[model samples]
Target chain A: MLDIKNLHVKLEEEDKVILKGVDLKIEPGSVHAIMGPNGSGKSTLSYVLSGRAGYEVTDGSVTLDDVDILDMEPEERAAAGLFLAFQYPVEIPGVGNMTFLRTAVNAQRKARGQDEMSAAEFLKVIREKAKTLQIDADMLKRPVNVGFSGGEKKRNEILQMAMLEPKMCILDETDSGLDVDAMKLVSEGVNALRDAGRSFLVITHYQRLLDHIKPDVVHIMSDGRLIKSGGPELALEVEQNGYADLKADAGAV
Target chain B: MARADLKKEKHEATEARISTLNMPQGGTWASMARNEALSRLRGMGLPARRDEYWKYTRPDTLIQQDAPAAALFDSLEPAVFDSVDRLKIVFVDGVFDAAASDDLSLSGVEIDRLETAAAADIHWAKDVYGRLEARGQTPVARPLAALNSAYATDGILIRVTGKAAKPISLIYTHKSEASDAILHHVIKLEKGAELTVLENGPAASRFNKVMEVEVADGAKFHHIRAQGRDHERRAATHLFTRLGSESLFKSFTLTVNGALTRNEAVIEFSGDNAVAHIAGAAMGDGAFHHDDTVFITHDAVNCESRQVYKKVLRNGAVGVFQGKILVKEGAQKTDGYQISQALLLDDDSQFLAKPELEIYADDVACSHGSTTGAIDQDALYYLRSRGVTKKEATDLLVLSFMAEAVEEIEDESLREEIVTRLTGWLERRSG
Candidate 1:
């Protein structure tokens, strides 16, 4: 459902290369995890796919269901079913959490030429979704992510993912700051939305999170390129041996 | 020119402007007050470009003899405070319209016209007509308010002895192209009394207004006003209030779409343990210049004051803020806070701020902050990444920037009304 080919990216303000000659593909109804050491360009790949600023795509193409999304604005990319769960959710001081979600949901729907959801209907749906995420009325009423705990922020991101229902989801270190219980809760939320047409690209530094969501494919990304691809056992190998030996082995290859 | 010559020239200009105005005939006390105000204005002279307080804002148009012509703005939106049940006092180009106004009778309060009260032999307004204006001139000069007190044609005088059931709404409508309107209002709140005043409109092509409020011991006063959306209009307004012991005062103003507007508020704490808050939200687009000047004095012990002002400017619009907090000797335990922020949507817009604190008391806590910036890119991208259009996201952030000032309104309905107007302004400019 998602495809990337020889993606080349560099910092827009400087000549430093971030993602160099990277390529990956994910099928429909599948879960993939990209594990790498620090500064291996895992986050850059995700950012490039989401159309964030300050990154120049020197070469390459990324597509969702064979439709190119590289030229679209961030909002248009989001409306076209591309969602990126940020590592650190922005804290907006004045926009309420529920208001932000409603605006997003309606905006995406309107962009897709679908009828907007009524306020009453939205409230009912959000209440149901929030209950599963353990987000209370007060949290929804408060400003977006202002004074929110790590667990609450992750759960809020999951809640947004569930509401937007994007076709392809890129989780950028969603488990970075989450506790054990929060990881379980977030993984459960992600697991619940695993439909036949939805795909996930989980980027992580540890296997503890994979234990909860259970990806089908694992890739070892080193030096801005995916050098190793294998079954779920690959994640266990990296967890046990670390990326040091993998880098040497890839160099030997 | 030498300093003496400059002063003489300014005084001569002030005299020239005063010579053209015909002071209304009134009672002994009123006439005496007008004469006092005229002399005070002459001493200070009108604001000039070289004045320290008027550096960021020009005073030529506001101080000129003939009011500049302004094309009437045709607004489809309903007048502010139309939904609230209020005692309406309508004014067409500064002339009181009795036929369009409610009767001058309400329980717990006494309402009278300044024209009528000033002509009487003895009236309660005689003590307040120019008293507060004259008091506010020291330390800094406000010649415009002095001029208003001296030659204002008509205004409302309200005296509240108890809780007012409904708010008194002052609505101004402009019909003449070159109308120059001057109005002065006096509000007297007795001990433990409470009152709310609501004002809205573009009074005339060139409008000058002064409102004097005396909040007695333990009294409460709330004021919410909106300067109308007349793109070519010019206005200068002053609010001078004195708070007695344990009294409370809060005022909020929302301004949008005017060519030139200068709003000044001076508050003095006369007795101990008083609280006062002044806030404003202004939005200006091309050819617009809005200024907010505030001075708060803490004279008694343990008094609190807050000043919050926010402005949104785009397309070469200009905004100015000059705020000061003065804590006098013996005014220990004073808590004073001031913040002025501006959000400039484009590179052409400008914001100038001067925040000052003068403290003679060592045990006072006073802080002031001023900032001018563009939209937060991180926040903007976060919103756009969530599928919100860039325009909608910008509007949301703009509203959020002004939310601090708007939140100062004590009434929920009034806050919502202000928010609706802000949203409408953003939406109208979205394209």
Candidate 2:
């Protein structure tokens, strides 16, 4: 459902290259996790796919359902069923959480030429979804991400993903600041949306998240490319023996 | 060349401007008050570019010999506050329109036109006509307010003895392109009484207005004003209010689409344990210049005052804010908070702010802050990434930036009206 081939990205304000010739593909109804150390361009890959600013895709192509997404704006990409759950969700001081979610839902619906959701209908759906994530009415009423705890932020992102129901979802370090309980709650929320048509690209530094939401495939990214691809057991190997040996092996290759 | 010659020239120029205005003919007390205001205006002269308070905003358009011509705007949108139940008082081109206004009588309150009340031999309005405006001139000179007090031709006088049944709505409609309108309103709330006043619409092409409010002990006063939507109209408005012991005063203004507007609010706390809040939200696009100058003084023990002002400007628009909070000696436990922020949508827009705090009370808590910034790009991206268009995202951010000032409105319906207007203003400029 998602494809990235020869993705070579460099910082727009600098000549330094981030993602150099990275390639990955994920099929429908599957979850793929990318494990890497710091500065390994894993997060950069997610940002490039989401069309974030400050990066120039020098040479690469990304597609969702065989439609080229490189030329689309961020909102267009979103309307085209691309979603990125930010690691650090932005703190908007005055935009209420409910208002933001409703606006986003209606905006995407209008972009897709579908009927907008009514306020009553939206409140019903959000309340049910929020219950599963332990997000209460107060959290939904307050400004988006303002004064939110780390776990609350992560769960809020999951709630957004649930609301949007995108064809492809990219989670960039969703487990970074979350505790064990939050990880399980978020993993359950993600697992609930694992339908036949949805796909996930989970980028994380640790395998603890994989323990909660099992991945069909795991990739070990060393420099700017995926050096190894294997099953869930690969995560165990990396957990026991860190990326030090993997880096040496990739360099030798 | 010398200071004396400069003063004499300024005095003569002010007199020339005054000679062109037709003072409203009234009875003994009203005429005396107008004459006194005239002398005060002469002493201060009209605001000049060299004046410290007028440095950021030019006073030329406000004090010019002839009112500059402005094209009338035909708005298809319904007037704000239409949904609320209010006593409507209409003014067309600065002249009171009795036929279009509601009955002047309301339970628990007495309301009369300034022309009629001033024509009476004895009236309660005589005590408040320009008293607060005169008191507001100390430590700073507001010659434009003095000019309005001296030559105002029409207004309303309200005295509240009990809780008002509904808000008194003063609607100003501009019908003449070159109409230079001057109006002064006086409101007196008796002990333990309460009242709310609503003002809206563009009065005229060139408008000067003053409102003086006196809140007696334990009384309450609320004011919400929306400046007219005529894009080429110019206005200078002043609100002078004094709060007595245990009284409460709150005022808010929303300004949209004016060529130039200067709104000044001066509040004084005279009795212990009083509270006052003044806030404004302004949006200006091309050729728009909006200014908000506020001075709040805490002179009684344990009084609280807040000033919140926010402005959104784009396409070379300019916004200025000069807010000060003064805590006098022996006014222990006084609390004063002031914040003025501007969101510049583009690099071409400008925001100039001067926040000052002069305190002599060691036990007082007074804080002031001012900021100018562009739209938060991170927040914008977060919104756009959620499938909202770039324009919509920017508008959301702008609204969020101004929400603080808008929240100062206490009434839910009034606040909603202001929010709706804010949204409409953003939508109209999106094109």
Per-residue lDDT of B23-71 in model 1, one digit per residue for the tens? 9999988899899999899889998888999999999999988999999
Q: Where does candidate 2 stray beyond 4 Å?
A: none
Question: If scored against the real structure, what TM-score would every candidate get?
Answer: 0.98, 0.98
**Pairs of residues at least 3 apart in sequence or in different chains that clash in candidate 2:** B202-B228
- As a whole number from 0 to 100, the lDDT of residue B179 in candidate 1 is 95
* Distance from true location, Cα of B66 in model 1, Å: 0.5
Model 1 Cα displacement at A13 (Å)?
0.5
Model 2, residue B115: displacement in angstroms?
A: 0.9
> Per-model i-RMS in Å?
0.8, 0.8
lDDT string for model 2 (A44-125, tens) is 8887888788899899899999999998989999999999999889998778999999999999999999999999999999
Docking class of 1: high
Give Cα distance to truth, residue B137, candidate 1, Å. 0.6
Worst ten in a row by lDDT for model 2 chain A? A244-253
Cα lDDT tens digits, model 1, A183-243, are 9999999999998999999999998899998999999888889989998899999989989
lDDT of 2 at B345: 86
